[model samples]
Target chain A: MEVLFTFLPKTAHQEKLEKEFPDVDFHFTYKEKSRLPSVDILVTYGEDITEEDISKAEKLKWIMVASAGVEKMPLQAMKERGIAVSNVKGIHKTPMAESVLAHLLALKRSLPFIYESQQNNQWNRKTGSSELFGSTALILGPGAIGSEIGRLLQAFGVRTIGCNRSGSAADYMDEMTSFEDILMKLPEADLIISVVPSTKETKHMLKKEHFEAMKKDAIFMNFGRGDLVEDQILLEALENGAVGYAVLDVFEQEPLPPEHPYWSMKNVVISPHASSHSKKYVDRALDIFIPNLHKWLSEDLNPTNLVNLEKGY
Target chain B: MEVLFTFLPKTAHQEKLEKEFPDVDFHFTYKEKSRLPSVDILVTYGEDITEEDISKAEKLKWIMVASAGVEKMPLQAMKERGIAVSNVKGIHKTPMAESVLAHLLALKRSLPFIYESQQNNQWNRKTGSSELFGSTALILGPGAIGSEIGRLLQAFGVRTIGCNRSGSAADYMDEMTSFEDILMKLPEADLIISVVPSTKETKHMLKKEHFEAMKKDAIFMNFGRGDLVEDQILLEALENGAVGYAVLDVFEQEPLPPEHPYWSMKNVVISPHASSHSKKYVDRALDIFIPNLHKWLSEDLNPTNLVNLEKGY
Candidate 1:
């Protein structure tokens, strides 16, 4: 079987794969190529792959996304070809969930204001710093990462509500809701975390209407794809007191422009999409890949984290 | 039964107590006076009461500490008098543990820097942020809050070790060690959170010797009493590259003197002693109090959270 690996040009992961699976022929290429035949599996990272490249992989029986989301992949073509798709879903869960909690705790405990005061060498002992206990957390996606977040939140005694495609109760979630029911539960949440993968249905999911439905002092966090929310609407919400504060780890564009209005917003915390890029990420990713590779070599029909081509998760 | 409520200027809590138990005669007095007659129970906050005061109350069978710790209570007198001393030990567990994770996460994710940069409208992005997954965490105390912190860290896939009085393995701790064994484990920790109360043994526990054993860039946090660590040693450690960064929520003397060097240190994040003070505290404290009070009144030896007068936790 011929396997094609597509990613940003920087890694020895392909070399490691070649050593482990010497019998299987492997080709390494960038995501921009127009055609690639005899490829049984194509692995790509981030949102760099084009639909044209995906269409040309005529013999591609499976698509292995190196990222957690398949939103950027040619889902329609993969579905038409009856190709199986799997994603590296749990790889980013640890760092992303930890970052979400970091921002939530920062906002709740007034870390920003405290740090700012510290820079001025001020020992201002401000009162009314809130705690996470008894706070309501509404996680927008209850996948492996979201469930892990819920477990962490449960340890702090926070009430967790999950929103997913099926609206089924997860182990750590106290309540479950569908996407349409989110507005009804928004006002009750003190913290709203967006972890849903980018999809046609999820794009602009958290718009002006959703923001308006949230509580006045609610904290908003986005560790998922940026396009899932409308940035301009979020800015307006932050300005008008519809949303108290926002911690954005992902953006519509990488390295958010310095002149962007979000840079100047005091209520907004903008990170350069580095939340999930941790020192241990490569090792952690390999941990998941090694076992799955073994399973694939044995002709396993179902991959561990099979992605629904139609759903784009 | 005569009950003495100690502390100056009692407010709504005392009034509520008065209304709830009208049949039991209660004497509310300031900490200065020692004229209270023999009482069956003594309820007190953070005020020093002499052995003479406990001696006067010949009928005092139980002491209920309004505060979390009984370090200031006349434990010797109570022990001699054969009076049971109970404290609000687990009440602060959720909030304090949350604070520990909060600051640790904040430090690891560069929240202080991100927050400050956001204020200046700067879009600075740094790489190689650390993740909690596969990281080792050494919790200095395995009390209620430390154990709760262990549970929180478990969800993030961190290996949690704890130090305790008996060196017995706690439910959430991967390994439990005595004070003498702490140095051996320090080199392995990526994060060290101190949640130990200020006992004679714990005071200045995280001093120069202990800090010297930690990893080069390890993150340190203290949600425990400030006396558990020496501020001067911590400052020196940070300066000499022994400790990378610290997040302190408690201080030796708060409001930490405005001229303190920590206020000017860039790598430190200091907060007032407000980590355990939350909106839900009063209700949660009452939840424990009401149930325990009923048991005490019924003479059922309601030893739900009996404090060890010797250990002083």
Candidate 2:
């Protein structure tokens, strides 16, 4: 069988893959040229993969996404072509969760202001410094990534509230609330972090009214899909002091155009969607992918993170 | 009985004190001009209290320090006069520990750089973003504040090494080592945090050799006493990359002079000694002080955090 990687892996990883599957034809490139039609398996980050690429790959039976988010991929086209898709889902929990805490602690401790003060060689102690202890956090989605974030936050004595579709109890969360009932819980949360996946139903989940329901000084963070809230609604909330601050790792548009108001907003922390970028990321992804590859090769069982095309996770 | 408060308590706290001790006179002022001679108990932050002030207070039986640090207090005079001393020691753990995490996370996530990038409206994703997981942190003086910091860091999957006088096992630490043996563990620590008290034995604990023994990329933090490490030694380490970064909340001099080299260094983050400054500081300090006051008034018992005059904690 032929395996094609649309993104360049580390030289050591390429060598390891070649050694592990000596019988398989392995092709690695950002631009996988003539072998596209003959590719039996495709591994990608799901960013550069398009509907046209799916149509050209006649021999492709399965698409393995190295990253958790599959929203950027052509799900409909893949579904129509009867292509099986599996993604490394829980791999981002560690780095992404750390990123959440990094932003939360930085903002809460007034590090941004402190750093700015350092630039002017000023030793200003009136930083409006605060602690995370006894504060309430509302984590939307509360899946693998959110639960990890909750676990870390709870360690610092933060009361974590996880929100999901059914309001099922999640590990490390003090309370659980349904997505439908979030409005009732908004005012009590000092922090609100969204880690929900992208989908039609999940799109624009937080609107202007949701921000209005929150406490005036509440910090809103979108580490999930950018479409979770309309950019304009969040901007208005921050601009009006309805939401005190925003720690954004995702945007409605990738690279978040230079003209975007968020870049200039003092209350907004832009992370350039780099929260999930870790040196160990590829290794962790392969830990899931390689084992799944073995299971797929030896048996007919589906891989662990097999995505449902209609749900689009 | 007369009690002198050199620091202002909250209006509500003042009312509470007056209501609780109606028979006792409560004097509040920065300059307790005429009351010093009549004062039975002095409640101060210990900064302005001098040996002369202690000598003037002929009626002073106990000094109720409202802060953790007693290094600046007139301990020699208080001890000579047979006056007892107590401070709100453990009250700083929550805010101080949270501050440690804030600085560590900020540096690890390249937040200072990210904030600078935001100023230029640059969407820079090449931030050397890292996670705190599976790293080693050497906590010097794992007492109340250090242990709390260790507990929080442990929850993030960091292996904590607590160093103290005896090197005895500490809560939340994976390993323990004596203050003398820290040089051996320095190379293994990705983060070194000093929370040791200021004493003759503790002063200049981290000198040129200690910094030389540390990992080249290790981050050093001084949240303890400014005298724990000589400023010149730390400056040399940072200048030579012997220490990768320094997060300082304490310095040899208060309001670290504008001419200080650390202020200009890109790798150093100066916090203006505000890590322990919390909105709830006075409340937490009062929580310890009020109960102690009741015990002292009803029964001639020593307060919970009664300091050993000779040991200077």
Model 2 chain A, TM-score vs. native? 0.97
Compute the DockQ of candidate 2: 0.80
Native contacts retained by model 1, as a fraction? 0.74
Worst 10 residues of 1 chain B by lDDT: B30-39
lDDT by residue (A1-313, candidate 1, tens digit) is: 7777665424577678778888888777766454366777776674665666657778877777777867766778778878888778888877877888888876776677667677776766564567887789999988888897898787777899999867888769999998988889998999898888788788887778899999998998888889988778888899999989888888887678878988877788888787776777666666666677678779886777888876677
Can you write out model 2's per-residue Cα lDDT over B1-313, one digit (the tens) per residue? Answer: 8899998887898998899888879988875556799999989988889888877889899888888889888788889898989999898899899889988887777777788888999999998777788889999989999999999998989999999999999998999999889899999999999998899889988889999989898999999989998888999999998989899999999989999998888888898999998889888888888888898898766888999999998
Indicate which candidate wins on TM-score: 2
Q: Show model 2 residue runs off by greater than 4 Å.
A: none
lDDT of 2 at B199: 91
**Residues A109-164 of candidate 2: C-alpha lDDT, one tens digit per residue:** 88888888999889899999888889999999898899999999889889999999
TM-score of 1: 0.82
Please give the lDDT score at residue B191 for candidate 1. 90
Tell me, what's the RMSD of every candidate? 4.5, 1.3
